[model samples]
Target: MAGLPVALAAAGALAYGTAFGLFGEDARTTAGAAAPAWAEEAADGFASVDALGQKGTYGGRGGPVVTVRTLADLEKYATAPGPHVIVVAGAIPVNPVGKEIKVASDKTIIGSGTSGHIVGGGFFLGPGVHNVIIRNLTIRDTYQGVWNDKDHDFDAVQMDGAHHVWIDHNDLRHMADGLIDSRKDTSYVTVSWNRLGNNNKTFGIGWTENTTADLTIHHNWFRETEQRNPSTDNAAHAHLYNNYLQDDPGTAVTSAYGNYARGRTAMVLENSYFQGLTNPVIKDATASLVQRGNVFSGTRGRNESGGTGFDPRRFYPYTLDAAADVPAIVTAGAGPRSALGTPRAAATRTLTVAKDGSGQFTSVQKAVDAVPAGNSSRVVIQVKPGTYREAVKVPSNKPHVTLQGMGASRKDTVLVEGRASGTPRPDGSGTYGTGGSATLAVEADDFQARNLTVANDFDEARNQHLTGHQAVALRTAADRVLLDALIISGDQDTLLLDTAAKDRPGRVRLTNSYVIGNVDFVFGRATAVIDRSVLTLKKRWDGTSAGYVTAPSTPAGRKGFLITRSTVNGDVTAGSFFLGRPWHAGGDATLDPQTTVRDSVLSAAVRPAPWTDMGGFSWKDDRFAEYRNTGPGAGPAGADRPHLTDAQAADQEIADWLGDWTPAAG
Candidate 1:
């Protein structure tokens, strides 16, 4: 434990050493109690186990039981002798001295509760290791071994040349490399009920020449994870079903073929839900993939590759879950904590806020500050129908918070602030960035707000003297956020779906909402979906030409903005407002922005040439496409407006975009 943090090191020496006995009876006796409810359900729902594939009991059955409370104890039990049911208790933070903590054959290491945590270090199931189960643990901040070094790649859970593994009910985040990776002949693995987020490479199944990997990943929630949401490479047979993927900046499931030896990577992705994703499925010409019963709402790019003619059932024996039922099922059961377990009474802890002191607090910020730190459960802060001029923020640690407005109409309840990008700090420091210049800013995950108005009442003409006049009404850097029936109003940069960074993109789902702005009003790098929403363009007070509706700064190879099944109408003059213009941040030539408007109604305010060049970048070089658009703006004659063909349009459905995330009616 050389790299152990002082806090973890202070937890003292290892407890419960080598007193445990071997075999099923001894293990059961040592375990003391039965498995948790989640564990039982995981076992019953494991696809590999239910399919009757592979070797002996996959999770510490017929083995010895040992409880570990420290990093040293975990290391001892994980590597000592054979077949162990290692119960890890308390927060075990590991700053590993070696490559990683290694796990031997036939082992089940489960956390006692949500308390079990592995920080800075990770577990490695290396060559010849088989029949393992790693469950109910929170693995975070994994060691960043060597940068861009494949051999020394650090992952929270790495299965190499291993088989018969079940990784379930675990929460993994902020890992350096892959969160969960399986490669080199690994077979018969099921990854379920895990919540993976804020990772660069989320999941990787097969490697260059490892063709024998068979992975089943289902009912897991992947939030704001980047590339390799299980990138099946070179002969990997992966079945991805009933998973909830939200705001993935990169492709969720990519069937990649190696250059040296291109094997048939067969992936059956069905009944999955995708929201605010760049590309749901990336099938190369050499790969074999099939997608069915998936739902997509505000997603960009084509869902499937042009390649076809591969049947998934021919390779694996498994029953397909209905895609229509997947959203409800996965949302209810996926992740470490069951969504169903979220008490209805949690909403009862409502803190009411009103401008006239008719509620518990006078302002929204007061109610938010009163919330207990590390609040695990959902807490609703109700705002009565009144305009409160304040800047509000929901910090990162205060998750599962909802800001509800008790307003009959969205315009009735308003949270208004007047901070532009050039607005200096109260302490007389430099101005806030575009992300910081928001009336309402949310950084917490699982945040929700409905039936309210977040308005940046900064007058664009008054702020014309400032250089960066971008004022955002709402800025969200959160995951799994839902904004419904809301009105976000501003001038430039009205609604900023801002993220912490380019690598860590935010996720927000907007439905039946109204966004009104001028120049690049709705912009950011976040993967945002605007479904059945209204995007309106307002005329500048100074009679300046109504600027671009969007100036998306989405990272290269990522989805920026999607307005689907919605309406874009405004009071602007005809041929004045272009749909969007690409914003090249820091003169990055590689930044290719993506924006799509399909199956929507556009007014005459939208120019015939809807996309234009901005910041020395051509909109034509970016990904801006429309399909089946019906309005005066819809045309086949415009050179700037790119239209999708019938075949391409067939792949651009909302069902294909959202995967299986069917948002409830607003």
Candidate 2:
């Protein structure tokens, strides 16, 4: 017909595609396991190749992430400038039917679990658009009730003159026209692990005059479709392998053909299974086509091949699934999976907490106490809108726990406590230290907190007699911790982003949130990514003492804190704040503290020389640097101020910080 296409549950690794580099291309699907890195997907095939001076198809990896539910918000972000990782939460109907939303360059539009659907509409990519990925979505219901009637041009995804695009793991059907229409010399594209069926004019590649398109179509199941089967024309390199194309009974007439190569297109078709199809493979006399190791079943008309097509291995490396296992692999592993949005492979159990005796527990801590110890599955402690003046802790044994607030704003549901660092413990164990004074301390892995406020209201101004005023609002020493839309407030040492030990891997991602403090408010040894958030530099309790923002004591050869696309400002004097200083924890010279403030706005509070020595460790001896900072406080790098070059900043990205792990909402 028309067109063709974390376990981290994380096991059963099926081998295929590019199984190298930071991203693994193995397919894994089992109960409580993931279907590859669905939450952290990057391009793999021809789209992953660097061409036209663009570095592969990594859509919105360096940009902020946004979640949209309505059609207007979806359209607003899809056509916006720069890049974004947009999560579609539910079905967005395309009004008046057959309407196509024009998506701009550098966007990753993925589904939130299996609920993201574009109803009666599709997406369109205009000329010169590049680096776009549309994955794990159901784009359907655009049928005009007239398949043979060719009046509407409503396609599931139509791209013209676009480059470096990847369409994967989606359910696209019931379209008015071709399911995927790639025209006007679109190149460096990959279509993998998609199910295309129940229509005519399935896939059409190339309606342009130039032979510039490079496509990799693999592991796609084209079922119950009539024709096209991705008819390629004037393609420079069209590599089709391990594709399962099966035509239902009838509809395979003289005019219907599968895998048509026309107009001098160089095509390589191999290891594909074709069942119950007429004219399974055909090529024009002038085209360069090569066919080998293809399995054909039932009936087929013309499976002809001639001329020597160009080899694809010279361009990029890719592995293929066996032709016999194509049916089993594509059918079971295709479409929008439920585990794509979830971090765990098993079903998540939920527990609610409210203050006024309306929930399962009276306080947030009580709900956390109710969780079964050493639990294997995810447990969500939903907190209602209330201010619970108590401490909350998730121990190391209690992993996969999320404390989500069921409130309209993050300010509504508050988990607060008043414990200064020097406050003596009731158990006579001495004072609660800076790390132990945290109102909310998460020591478990796979932790998440959203739409909540964690504050250590220790009254630093009232406690002028105290010596230690380090009040921590939140301290997390774990892996894969995501804090979204939260407000962490205190005076000094507010948020401690740490690791279990010097050898363990501890990573945290904080986005669309706020962290307010003065002295080393956001400090730790973890590889933390503070993205698109606000880091307000508050005045000290005396209202004149200037403080630092971050004090990282990262281990040697390990990454530290990364604050990107965020704003650093507060109600303080000009040049009163340093970006960060190296903190050699426990006077350990082996710890190399580092902090990078990149693509962020620094108000008048930040000093020109934003880094310095701490605990006898020189900042220059470590990895402290800045890149592309703006606003009044930003300046060029000197001997005292380190700045990262363009090439250097490219290497230190979010992907480099959080390796194979992609943080998701619990």
Quality of model 1 by C-alpha lDDT: 0.69
Which regions in candidate 2 have their CA more than 4 angstroms from the true location? 1-345
lDDT of 1 at 231: 75
Top lDDT hit: 2
lDDT of each: 0.69, 0.82
Cα lDDT of model 2 by residue, 174-287, tens digit: 788988999999999999888898778899999998989999999888887777798999999999999998876755323367898999799999899898888899998878
Predicted candidate 1 versus true structure: per-residue lDDT over 464-496, tens digit per residue: 788788888899887656787777887788887
User: Which TM-score value belongs to model 2?
Assistant: 0.57
Best by TM-score: 2
lDDT value, residue 350 of candidate 2: 97
